[model samples]
Target: MSQPEPGAVVDLLGVLAYAELTAFDRLAEDARLAPTLTGRAALARMAAAEIAHHVRLTDRLVELGADPAAAMAPFTSALDTFHESTRPSTWLEGLVKAYVGDGLAADFYREIAAFLPEPDRLLVLEVLDDTGHADFAVREVRAAIVADRRLAGRLALWGRRLVGEAISRSQAVIAEHDGLADLIITGTGDLAGVGRLIERITSAHTERMTTLGLNP
Candidate 1:
């Protein structure tokens, strides 16, 4: 595969930077839904990391001489649509959304980071959510499922919907942003590679759901 043009990387950097900012905002808002003080604090810490990522990415964008807001603008509509459509109805559902939804996104970013050039690639890899957040989500979600077996179906169904909406928006991004698509393909080789990436993400998500005692 040919190397992506410098312009494409710039576009990707913008997208990534904006994505981190918005993710931080959403996670911070969702943190309010946590049931306990410890859970809330855990989510707050995760949100703080996201904010730090946003700051780093934004600084990188400035270093690249790109307009950070403009770079993020193109993604705003579809991302807004996804969040609006998938708002959690309960505290447990919120935890599920944070864990399952964001976990999948983190995996996607990690896969895509492999294709980026240095500094940018390293930044992407470094910004991923830590295991502490994942462990907290898993513990909370599993406890909920165990306490009430009936929630398994509902949470599973919600998880599937979150994944579906995520994929839909992802396709929208790929379709509308040739630069991002080029970056991904250039890094991963071809359509098959992207499919494998998605498969790996889905497999991880399945394990997460199973760990929570929910059928995937």
Candidate 2:
């Protein structure tokens, strides 16, 4: 478990900043594999959105008197390992990974944001906004499934595996960061609150899968 000490807002911002930067790189790379001009453009735009977020988070970290690189450094391994292990084998896998992974991450952050105070809370909410990518993923994945019914089973399994890996990696992250782990441990205050948080995340994930026409 991470050192159980009190943490600053920079800790959270740093984590988010690094995650955004990494997502930008990955999305940009995936853009090259797009099957059509529309997809390439969409992915490029997505990557750019991530760059905007990374910049915001990095600037905020500087304002908070935290070294952006230092703040983000500790998280590289956890995130990198997860990405490497779950690297998609197909374009649809990439989309599914982005959709399912981002949804769960946003849900988790939103829950954690409830425990933050003032401007940071509002900032987190605003930065983590969906930007309609999930909807695009749902439409694309659904259309593909319609074209090949066999894809439904494989994609459903992929969705499940992605979420499961996410859960595992998230727990590892929480365990390694006192700021995050302590927040979840103390802010939730009781097992019941923790349970509720998990339930909310799970329910939201179910809805997202259903929207993608996949079984949860």
- Residue pairs in collision within model 1: none
* Model 1 lDDT tens row, 1-216: 566777676776766776777676777777788777877787788778877888888888788888788777887888788888998878788788878888888888788777777888788888774636677778888888788889889999999999999999988888998877888876777789878888898899898777777788
Model 1 stretches astray by more than 4 angstroms: none
Model 2 lDDT tens row, 54-98: 888888778777889999998899889888888888888888888
Provide the global lDDT of candidate 1 against the true structure. 0.80
Give the root-mean-square deviation of each candidate in angstroms.
Answer: 1.7, 2.8
- Which portions of model 2 show Cα errors greater than 4 Å? 1-6
| Residue 83, candidate 2: C-alpha displacement in angstroms | 0.4
- What TM-score does prediction 2 earn? 0.94
